[model samples]
Target: MVFSLKGKTAIVTGGGSGIGKAISTTFARQGAHVCILDFSTDNGNNTVSEIEKEGGSANFYQCDVSNQEQMETIFDEIAKNKTINILINNAGIAHVGNIENTNSEDLDRLFNVNIKGVYNGMKAAISHFKKHKSGVIVNMASIAASVGISDRFAYSMTKGAVLTMTYSVAKDYVNEGIRCNCISPARVHTPFVDGFIQNNYPDNQAEMFEKLSKTQPIGRMGKPEEIANLALYLCSDEASFITGSNFPIDGGFVTLNN
Candidate 1:
């Protein structure tokens, strides 16, 4: 099947860098007019400029997905220009702490961004999707959603909500022609990983990076573009039959991890 998105309009949250940037770029390359919603104005503008440089259509909107007021205003403005055909809930924050170390504030922050962010995006775009009678919603979940990981109590909790939210949206909106699904990726090689390494193990960054990469059975971390590839397919018309499913793009980490 041809995975063409020509003439389509997609809204990608956190489209400034990492997996979100990759997904936004992929959508633009596929001929979709993309709206990059990011909290980082500079990064968002840079991403839009990059897409335009490649002869693609795109716009940047500075938005904090966790804030209801900000999301509403941004959606209202976007609706004025065009109907949103795809919504990628990719804005998320990662927390490193076990249950005992994780305080209520930590859990709340994670939930607000990871879980509520996805919820807000879906909620904001549902009306547009309903009006058009068709739409695709893809959430960026994590392997932590389905499996336990060390020092990720709050992050895991939020991702689990993302997985279930995808399922719930798919079930409720099936009749409305809105497809909701999620992609669960493991240990992707993004700037976040680099930052974590630099901040935590300043002296042994490379050694720790290697150790983290080796955590995957594939012996390396997954690339951002690799996750984007899966996302591209899931959002394309080729995946019309698929919904309410969690696609694991984890270098066999979920199934083969010992």
Candidate 2:
């Protein structure tokens, strides 16, 4: 029970699928009342149902993290009845292109979801945490933020901003019992990755998947549950001493990869 989140109310952005879904379910299993904020009501509701089936408490709120008004409205509603103790900024979109190939539109789209989305979530959660004098924020960054990766100009930029924002928020709110940190994972294996390969490499999805997996020095992509476990630990009371840190859960991609 060292990492117990009993009686805690946790909010996870993009909790419908991928890493977000994993974190949501994991947190719920740890006894937290989880609120999933996702754009896809179907997926979000599905996750909620699954949690309920497992005897865990959860609710789904349809939302787009990029829209400040929508986020503010939903966060306010959550705060009405529940004191939110944790926020996971895991909603983000992927873009594949270097600076020249990435047009202004692409950059703006990435900025809105990846960068501004984190900002919106943090901004909304900060007010609640400020009032309570305690909160934990776990942000999902990417190895792209620290290492130079080809064809990921915009993504790298946004994740880099996430890292800094984690630092700034943690430093600013540390005295108030608020802790902020980020996790950087390299190529997590999710449905999105499978779909990406199937759509882009219809004739050779398996081959492309293998190629992508080998890109990591560990010879395989990270798992969504693995990332979730890390997030759970970071958000728990056991991590009280942890803040303003960026944990790279990459499969040796940051160090061993040449």
Candidate 3:
């Protein structure tokens, strides 16, 4: 019962796949009624079904986090029938390119999803939290925010914003019982990774995948479950004393890399 979320209602954006799906599934298993918001209908529905199959409470909502109006509507609907306890801003798009290589369109795309998406989720949750005087927010950041990674200019920019946003929210709501924090994971073995490799390295998928994995000093990519477990702890009552902290779950990538 250390990390128990019994009776709590948790909302996870991008809950269809990768770390988001893992967090949703894990939250449901920990006795939470999980609401999964994702743009992919199939991925969202499949995740909910799988959670239910495991005898966990879960529901899927088709959502584009960047759409403020849509997000507000969904959040309002949830608040009407259930008390929102936790919000996870895990819905984001990744861009791979330095400043010169990244075009305006690419920058805009990252800003819309990676930046505005988190803003919308936080905006929607803050009101409910203020009314209830208690809430937890766990944002998914990246090591790129802290470390200077090559060819990740745009991605790093947004992640850096997320880190500071966590700090600002945590400080602003400290007395209101709202805790805001972010998790920075190195590379995780998700379907997105597979797709990235397949699409970009069709001729040398395995080689490229291995190269990416080795980027982490740990010699392998982190698992989705690993990130999900950390998320579970952050949102649980056990972490009530923790706020305004940036957790780097990078498997030595941030520090050990020479």
Candidate 4:
């Protein structure tokens, strides 16, 4: 029964693909009634079908996390019939550019989805959490938040905000029965990674992919499922005593990269 999410309702933003999809499916498998919020209708519906095929309960909501009104409405709507137990802020966009190359538009784009999106999710759920007096939040951060990841200026800045936000929320709600924490993955192998390599290095996709994977000291990039497992635990009862923490699931990249 440990880490079981039975009878609980978990909401995962960006639940359509990549690490988000892995987390959504994992939560559904863990017996949670999963609410997947994703902007991509195709991906969202597909994911819901996949979970349904597995005999798990799930629903898909097309959402733009940066849209406050949309996020608030969806959260409230879901809260009406189900007790909101967990919120996973896993929706984010990535950018690769240092300060010199990153324009204001680029910084703004990442900020909108990575930083504001997390804020919106948390804001929309905090009230219900306080009313119920119990809730868990797991945000998807990045090792770039703590380490000097070259050419990830905007992405790193946003993730660092996520880290601090986790601490602040956990501290503020510690006595309110709400727990907040984040997972900072080094580099997870997801569809996004594949696409990134294929699009940018079409001639040497495999080589580029391997190069990126080996960047992790563990000799490979982390799996989306691995990150999902960590997320499930953080949102489970087994982690009741855990909060205000940042878990670096970076394949030792943060520690061994020296």
- Quantify all predictions' global Cα lDDT against the true fold: 0.93, 0.96, 0.95, 0.95
Report model 3's TM-score to 2 decimal places: 0.99
Per-residue lDDT for 145 in model 4?
90
Clashing pairs in 3: none
lDDT of 1 by residue, 1-258 (tens): 377889889999999999999998988999999999999999999999999999999999989899988997888898897888999999999999899999999988898999989999999999889998899999999999999899999999999999999999999999999999999999999999999999999999999999999999999999999988888898898999999999998889988988
lDDT order of candidates, best first? 2, 3, 4, 1
For residues 65-103, write the lDDT of model 3, one tens digit per residue: 999999999999999999999999999999899999999
Candidate 4: misplaced stretches above 4 Å? Answer: none
Q: What is the lDDT of residue 196 in candidate 2?
A: 91
Q: Write the per-residue lDDT of candidate 2 for residues 105-209, one digit (tens) a residue.
A: 999999999999999999999999999899999999999999899999999999999999999999999999899999999999999999899889999988999
Q: How good is model 4 by TM-score?
A: 0.99
Model 3 off-target regions past 4 Å? none
* Candidates in order: C-alpha RMSD to true structure: 1.0, 0.7, 0.7, 0.7
Q: Candidate 1 or 2, higher TM-score?
A: 2
Q: Where does candidate 2 stray beyond 4 Å?
A: none
